[model samples]
Target: MKLSNEVKFNYPREDIWKALHDPEILKHAIPGCEGLTLQEDGSYDVSMSLGVAAVKGKYNGKVYMTDIEKPNKYLLEAEGSGSPGHVSMKMDCNLEETEEGCLLKWDCDAEIGGKIAGVGSRALGGIAKFMAKKFFDDIKKQLKKGAYTN
Candidate 1:
């Protein structure tokens, strides 16, 4: 599946970039995310429960950030598994400063296997896109509320 979205945050680009690197901010932004731990070597362990549109399950995943250009762009690769199936996804992200705030552009590709693949691929894409938008909106709100103190 391929997904893309653009969101504008009501903060400076630097602050938004910092929030993106903060585990706490990430945990809060992801729907049903229970916890996020940032390991010393640029790896992250994430625990999350997902019940979006057509799929419901708990996932434990590791994400690695690469091709990072701090405060500007990066690539994220992640994989997770659950009783229903497994998910592997990759995303390329770009951030640009706007007079009002910052504009974020995200492009992603994902694949599902096992039971989750039984759901229609088109339906799955829609569901995943919705979830992604929700996640970004959550992050924007948190930043607006001064939730990321760091």
Candidate 2:
């Protein structure tokens, strides 16, 4: 599946970039994240427990940030598996500076296999979008509360 979205942030691009990379902030924003550890190799180890309908399960995965352009853009790649199924995604994330703050945009390509894939593409698409929105909203709330992850 492929999905795209843009979120407006009332914070500076630099600040948004920092928040996105901060492990604590990411752990807080990721809907079901149990742990987010930054590895010395610049990758992240993630553990998540999700109870969302047919996709409910505990997942462990590694995420890699590549093609980084500092406070501008980067590629996020992740793959995880659980009792329900397996999922992998590659998302291009961009942060553009705007007059008010920052405009964060992302385009993602994802693949799923096993029981989870049985949920149908349309349903999965909606779920992915919902999860994405929650993630961004959580970040926005943190920024507003001055919860600087770094």
TM-score, prediction 2? 0.96
- Residue pairs in steric clash, candidate 2? none
Local accuracy by lDDT, each model: 0.86, 0.92
lDDT of 2 by residue, 1-150 (tens): 999999999888999999999998999999999999999999999999986565689999999999999989999999999998899999999999999999999999999988889989998899899999999999999898886533
Cα deviation at 128, candidate 2, in Å, is 0.4
Give the worst 10-residue stretch by lDDT in candidate 2: 141-150
lDDT, candidate 1, at 56: 81
In Å, residue 134's CA in model 1 sits off its true spot by 1.0
Off by over 4 Å in 1: 52-55, 148-150
lDDT of 1: 0.86
lDDT of 2 at 36: 94
Error of 1 at 45 (Å): 0.6
For model 1 the local lDDT of residue 77 reads 94
